[model samples]
Target: MSFVTDHILKNPPVLLGLIAMIGLIVQRKTFAEVVKGSLTAVFGMVALTAGVNMLTGTIAPINTAVQTQLGVQVADGLSDVTFTAEYGGTVGLAMFLD
Candidate 1:
């Protein structure tokens, strides 16, 4: 049953539809009502996934353009060590008090 479980976990929309259908059936919903409710849930999830994909796709080009234009240089690990050396004692005391 590992194969079955793997497929079930991978497709969350299907799992959610199955759960909604089962809940509706247990509540003695009509056949039509069960089908409608389950399909609505599944389609809603699909639409949400599509919308998020489109949003991310649209933002990626903008992000790339901004990063390229900015020509920003980030300092390496030197700053992190310097910060700790300067403030480590104060931070350690604050944490001890907390």
Candidate 2:
């Protein structure tokens, strides 16, 4: 249905878990093994997402402090600046190249 496609399919963790389950099934794994593999994949993705979010959160304050110490100025008409807002394009390009 639309809900399944929109929610479960679009979600990376769940899609990965489904792939794991399908692979286990193809290998003739037991039910418990299939369930365990799928859950493990899902949990791993969740953990990775959590870790990235945590790292970004930790970096925000450090970025703010460095900007403050360096006396960085905000551009005109901008009320607030953020680490991502300032460096996201460069970071994205670096990531794309890598």
Candidate 3:
């Protein structure tokens, strides 16, 4: 049908891939090797993912303890603090301290 042809033309990659897969199947391409290779890659990625999770898990507790004991949140060196100034008075970090 014209509609099917138009749809295929609009999505060339999908159309080409579908045709290639059909051809491979007609030519008797066994998917056994492909499945094995994919499984191996997935296993390697799973190991790396687990290691990253463990690394973060160890650091999280230390960060929480520092914030709780200090009563201030540490984020990129900008602690949660506020300041007020009297005009024409002492200035700089010294004034903020006193």
Candidate 4:
């Protein structure tokens, strides 16, 4: 599932699936009192996500300000650091496991 659509969307289906499971929990808590409660749980998640998106919008500016005001610089985002090495051995993971 991830291999096919990991790059397609920012939130990804995994997040939605998790939200749905939690939404179910919320519905169960009230014994599924009404359909509106379940729907509200889902909508609440959407609203929460929107709020987080707004908060994240300021991260860049906040980072810049902190870096500029203070002498401390912060490293953010992904990094391209990898090491490749070839080994010649029995490759011991755990002899008992094998």
- Of the candidates shown, which would achieve the greatest lDDT relative to the real structure? 2
Backbone clash count for every predicted candidate, in the order shown:
0, 0, 0, 0
Predictions: Cα RMSD each: 14.7, 8.6, 22.3, 11.6
Instruction: For candidate 3, write residues 25-66 as lDDT tens digits.
Output: 666767864444445555655676578778878987998998
RMSD of 2: 8.6
lDDT head-to-head 1 vs 3, winner: 1
Predicted candidate 1 versus true structure: per-residue lDDT over 1-98, tens digit per residue: 44434454345566668767878998999999999999998898789878887997899688778868997644556553466555544554443345
Q: How far is candidate 4 from the true structure (C-alpha RMSD, Å)?
A: 11.6
Candidate 3 has an lDDT of 0.49
**Cα-based TM-score, every candidate:** 0.61, 0.61, 0.38, 0.39
Q: State the lDDT of candidate 4 residue by residue for 48-79, as single tens digits.
A: 76787788776868878888999897554332
Q: What's model 4's overall lDDT?
A: 0.46
Clashing pairs in 1: none
The CA-based lDDT of model 1 is what? Answer: 0.69
- Where does candidate 3 have its weakest 10-residue lDDT segment? 80-89
